[model samples]
Target chain A: DVKVTQSSRYLVKRTGEKVFLECVQDMDHENMFWYRQDPGLGLRLIYFSYDVKMKEKGDIPEGYSVSREKKERFSLILESASTNQTSMYLCASSLGGKGEQYFGPGTRLTVT
Target chain B: AQSVTQPDIHITVSEGASLELRCNYSYGATPYLFWYVQSPGQGLQLLLKYFSGDTLVQGIKGFEAEFKRSQSSFNLRKPSVHWSDAAEYFCAVWSGSSASKIIFGSGTRLSIRP
Candidate 1:
């Protein structure tokens, strides 16, 4: 089975603090994505990496950035955490095809 | 711009009752649609997908979906929903003639009441 693992299942950060969420996929997929899910708002894309060192902003990339230094791992960074940035962050990876994506367990970030 | 919509925000059904979740899309060309389920505090799982070919497609976990081009909709259905089937269902669309980015619906929360 394809497996995607996230660094933390839950995290708490103070305002203006930097936060990092890491994700690793064992399937060697070409595409990885970061999304923040909120009640009623659903899963909104934050950023996506198609290849190493390549990143693209998604619908809600304002307070977030992403890193793809290696093929197996992707990182999401919140330059300065804010109260509004708290949400359940999800990481997903998929092959080049238009097939289904495999997602990690998710990191619930709480900004205080 | 391509987009997806799930009309219902939440649905309640008794265990062993039939279930159907509505999804609609707006895209210039034929779109690739998918249904995903997410249990509480877990990542989403793919339930079914509609790319081309047959309109009715069977998927994992006793779930199925039908794609209707005329209505631009892909609705998921289950003959008998179990209690474990309670989860959030999201519908996504990608209009990739060659390549495409996915756009997801707000999602429908399924509540199975016994």
Candidate 2:
């Protein structure tokens, strides 16, 4: 079975602190994505990477960035954490087709 | 340009009762639809997807969804509700282009009464 793992299941950070959320996928999927989910608004895409070292901005890219150094790993970076950024962050990987996505157990971030 | 809508915010049903969740989408061309279930504090799991071909698609956990092009609706249904099935369900659709981005609906919360 394909598996996606997140570095942390729950995290608490102070305001203005820099944060990193890691995601690793065993499957060699060509595409990786980072999304933030909130009540009522649903999951909004923050960023996505289609290939190694290549990234694209999604709808809600403010205060968030991504890095894909290896095909199996993608990282989401928050330059400066804020209270408004507290939410469930999800990572997903998919092949470059009309294929289903495999998601990692989300990381719930709480900013104080 | 593509979007998805899950009309129901919350639904409650007794065990052994039937279930249905509505999903509506708007896209210019043919749309690829998907249903996903998320347990508390967990990632979303793919329940079913419809790309083309047959409209009725069966999924794991005794779940199924029907795609109606005329109504732009893909509704999920199950013959009997289980207590373990209580979770948040999301409907999503793919916007076909070079980017091929997927957009998710607001989601519907399901509650099963024992």
Candidate 3:
């Protein structure tokens, strides 16, 4: 079984703070993704990394950045967290071919 | 652009009752379809996927979904509802390209009554 683990399950930060959400996968998948889930809006992609040091912006990449220094770890960074940035963040990994992604337990972020 | 739509926002069913959750998608060419379930405060879990060959696909936990090309729909079904089946169900689509991103639906929250 593929196991995806996140660094934190819940987090609270003040406005304008820098926040980091980490994800690690044991499956050695080549693709990693970050998404923010909101009610009635579904899961919107924030960023994705296809390989180490290679990143692409997804539909809603504003106010967020990603790091993939290693194959097993992906980190999402909020340059300046705002109240609007509060959301349930999810991380996923998949082998490059199949489009089947395994997800980690989400981190519920609260930006006050 | 690829997109998915789960029409029902919320559904309630008694335990042991048949269950069906509607999902519609918009995409060009043959698309990759998937269904996922998310428990409260949890990440999404893959329930099933439809790539090709067969229109009907079986998924985990007695769940299944059928793909209809004419209707552009992939609706999930279960023979009987269980208390554990209560969760938010999302339908997603990918354009079949290696670099294409998968789009997810708003999701339907299922409520099981005992």
Candidate 4:
């Protein structure tokens, strides 16, 4: 089975603090994505990487950035956390950008 | 531009009652349809997918969806509802323009009543 693991399941951070959310996939998928899910708004893609050192902005990428340093590890970075940034962050991995994407259990982030 | 729509925001059904969740999408070329279920506080799980050929696709947990090109809909259905089936269902369409990007619906929450 393809497993996608996130570094933390729940996180609380203060305003203006820098935060990093890590995701690792064991399926050797070439594509990794970061999305923030909000109530009624669904999941909005923050960023996605098709390969190491490559990234693309998604619909709602204003408050977020991402890095893909290795094949298995993809990281989401919040430069300055704010209350509006509080939401559930999800990480997913796919083989070639098609088919089913394996997702981690998600990290619920709360910024105060 | 492509988009997905799940008109029903929430649904409730008694156990053993039949259920249906509607999904509609808009895209120019051939569309790749998928149904995913997200349990409480859990990640989304692939329930089924419709690429081509077969319009009726069976999925996990006794769930299935049918693709209707004319209506541009892929509706998920289950013969009987169970408490375990209570979850959020998202309908997504694979954007052909990209290699691995998908447009997801707002999601429909299913509730089960005993």
CA lDDT of each prediction against the hidden true structure: 0.91, 0.93, 0.92, 0.93
Worst 10 residues of 2 chain A by lDDT: A93-102
Estimated TM-score for each candidate: 0.97, 0.98, 0.97, 0.98
Compose the digit string of candidate 3's lDDT tens values, residues A1-112.
Answer: 9999999999999999999999999998999999999988889899998889999998899899999999999999999999999999999999887578889999999999
**lDDT string, candidate 2, B16-85, tens digits:** 9999999999999888999999998899999999999999999999999999999999999999999999
Tell me chain A's TM-score in each of the predictions.
0.98, 0.98, 0.98, 0.98
Ranking by DockQ: 4, 3, 2, 1
| Reference A-B contact fraction recovered by candidate 1 | 0.53
Residue pairs in candidate 4 whose N, alpha carbon or C atoms collide under 3 angstroms = A97-B100
Docking class of 2: medium
Task: Judging by lDDT, tell me the better candidate of 3 and 4.
Answer: 4
Which residue runs does candidate 1 get wrong by more than 4 Å?
Answer: B95-100
Which has the greatest DockQ? Answer: 4
In candidate 4, what are the lDDT values of residues B24-64, reduced to their tens digit? Answer: 99999889999999999999999999989989999999999
Report the C-alpha lDDT of model 3 over B1-114, residue by residue, as the tens digit.
777888899999999999999999998888799999999999999999999998999999999999999999999999999999999999999856575467889999999989
Error of 3 at A46 (Å): 0.3
Task: Give the poorly placed runs of model 4, Cα more than 4 Å off.
Answer: none
Better of 3 and 4 by DockQ: 4
